[model samples]
Target: MQLSPDEHIFWQYGFVKLNATIVFTWALMLVLAVGSKIITGKLATGLKRSRWQNLMEIVVVAMENQIAEVGLREPRRFLGFIGTLFLFVAIASLCTIIPGFKPPTGSLSTTVALALCVFVVVPLFGIEDQGLIGYFKSYLEPTVIMLPFNIIGEISRTLALSVRLFGNMMSGEMIIGILLTITPYIFPIVMTLLGLLTGMVQAYIFSVLATVYIAAAMGDQGLKQEPEAQQ
Candidate 1:
């Protein structure tokens, strides 16, 4: 059995090739884009609303509430970024039920890209909230000797994010594949349901961790300002 969606190549031109990961990822993005636009186009501000609109608003509000609970003061400011991350991962896993369809997240490249997005956004948001100097100054907190360690921690966490997602997704796919081979009927169906639950849980976890990181950045800035205010 193929270990990853990367193994399914659709096209090749010398050194360049298109694989299932790239194709499925783009397909997923397109669906999300078009679906969102369609759903939002007729958004009603009045008492009467479509069921789809209500459902969409519920999901969005729940996500925003979760972000606020995580310590982000203005959740809307971070909602777009964090919401997209959760939806992408959650949808990728949910779509696996389709026959012959594979989730791009089963590939290391996809997970790494997702993780790197988080890595980059962490500092960007921090800088936006704290100003460049103030954000960088966070590395010197408690002592300047912590600089290298802080830097290392950032890099290590990004790597961890990527590997954690990739391992969980790939292992799930592998387990399902093995079950299908050994007992082609009942067990695989049960496993598929469990996989869906696991996928959603993982999505929640990844999103929450990302929110924590962003909140920590802003929290550090708040802490730095507190002493000055007190003085």
Candidate 2:
């Protein structure tokens, strides 16, 4: 189907106008995942260098560096989760340039859903890394009495993640909409670029925090390397 100019540009490039581009984002994500996987294998086999390879290389390296810096002992295991997140948010946020496309992430629902996934996975992976007892103990951190406050803080992190992302994206969208209404000419260009940059940075911020949470739950609660750091 031909995307209405707004939908078309939004789907391909992450531009927004009216409605959120869930369908387009999902379809784009499916295609990118399939294509990236197929192309990654091909690249490993010495396929000719091309734009696609370069793009994928950039993504892979960035993800790897993030995982390493977060101090995840099994950085490779977090690769798929972190990479999928960064890519999804990155694409959804950037696709705002198309005339009609809205960013899915500007809505609290989308950000909450992503945060929920991190909430689920951290505990699951924490158990795998530290066992149930260890996971619980890790939460106690520096003192047993401080556990209650720590638990409350942990729960709030997910809330902060969702709210921060939704607020930033939505605020940007609202400001642009208002400006476009008053003076639709050169102003929107600046807003669009700012939106694009905001989207990219927010995506990185969200995923990196998720990584750190998982790393902590795995017993690196102090964010310091210890001999018995959980892998």
Candidate 3:
């Protein structure tokens, strides 16, 4: 059985090569981009709304509420990043029902890329909320010796996020592949449904963790703003 989409090569030219991971990743992104355009192109303001518009509104509202619940003072500020992350992972899993389609998320590279996006954004959000000096100074909080540890914690968590997502997604694929070989057809079908549920759960967990990290990066400023928001 194929352990990773990276192993499936579709094209190669000396140092450059195209694999299943790259192909599917780009394909999925295109689908998301075009679908978003089509869904949002004719948005309705009146009482009469299309089902897709209603669904989109529901998802946006739900995501905003989730971000607020995670302690972000301005949910809309973080909605684009957080919502995109959730939708990508959730949609990738949902597409598994399609024949001959492999989720790019099952590959370590894709997960690492996703984690790196969060990694880079966290510091940016921090700097935006608390100027450059203030954000960097956060590492030296409470004492000077904690600086290295704080930096290490940031790097370590990014690694953990990537590995956790890759492992879970890959394992789900692995189990279904194994089941198809050793078990009957009906059993594998049941497992596939369970895997879809697990994928959605993983997407939620990943987005929540990212929001928590961003909220932490916002530091005391976020806390200070929270009360004002409540009032």
Candidate 4:
């Protein structure tokens, strides 16, 4: 079976090449950009609103609530990053209904890139909230001996995020391809539907994990701010 979209090369130079992963990743991003523009360009504020606006509001509200429940004091602060991550994965999976479309998330490069975004953002968020000295000190929490272990844990979790997402997305695509070759057409169709659902679940899990990581990185800043804001 074609294990990854990376195998489908459309163009190549000595050191650079365009593959399905790159093409689809860009295409998906373009769709998101254009769709967001169109949907939000003429938003209504009165009693009546477009269906697209209503859908967007619902999604934003749901995401905000989810982030809040994850212990973030300001959901909107992280909403743009976390929401985009979720939408990209969710839409990439949903678009599988299109013939010849490959999900970029099925590729290790894409997932790694996504994971790296979280990995980088976590430290930045922590540094922003606690300042460099305070954030770096977190590694030696409770004692200095735990520093190396804390650093190792951070690296390991980032690797885990990438591998877990890549494996799940790639496996689902492989299963659907395999089923199509050996089983009835109807079976593959059902599997495709299941794959879509799986994709959405993966997206939710990935975003939530990212939010949790960021919250942890921020240490007790959110907790400290919450009571002050309430008063």
lDDT of each: 0.86, 0.76, 0.89, 0.90
- For each candidate in turn, the TM-score is 0.92, 0.81, 0.93, 0.94
Worst 10 residues of 4 by lDDT: 222-231
Give per-residue CA lDDT, model 3, range 1-231, as digits (tens): 788899899999997999999999899999999988999999999999999999999999999999988788889999999999999999999888888889988999899999999999999999999989999998998689999999899999999998988898899899989898899589889988998998899899889989888888886767434422210
Q: The CA-based lDDT of model 3 is what? A: 0.89
Residue 60 lDDT in candidate 3? 92
lDDT of 2 by residue, 155-205 (tens): 788889899988888887888888988999999889989999999999999
Clashes of each: 0, 12, 0, 0
Model 1 Cα lDDT, one tens digit per residue, 1-231 = 788898889998897999999999998999999999999999999999999899899999999998877777788989999999999999999998988879888899899999999999999988888999988998897699999999999999889888888888888888989998899999999999998998998899888888887877775543322222210
- lDDT, residue 110, candidate 2: 72
Across 1-231, the per-residue lDDT of candidate 4 in tens digits comes to: 678899899999976999999999999999999999999999998999999999999999999998888888889999999999999999999998898999999999899999999999999999998899999998898699999999998998899999988999999889988888899579989989999999999999999999888888786766323322210
- CA lDDT, candidate 2, residue 103: 71
TM-score of candidate 1 against the unseen true structure: 0.92
- For residue 186, model 4's alpha carbon misses the true position, in angstroms, by 1.4
Q: Which ten residues in a row have the lowest lDDT in candidate 3?
A: 222-231
Candidate 4: list runs displaced more than 4 Å.
224-231
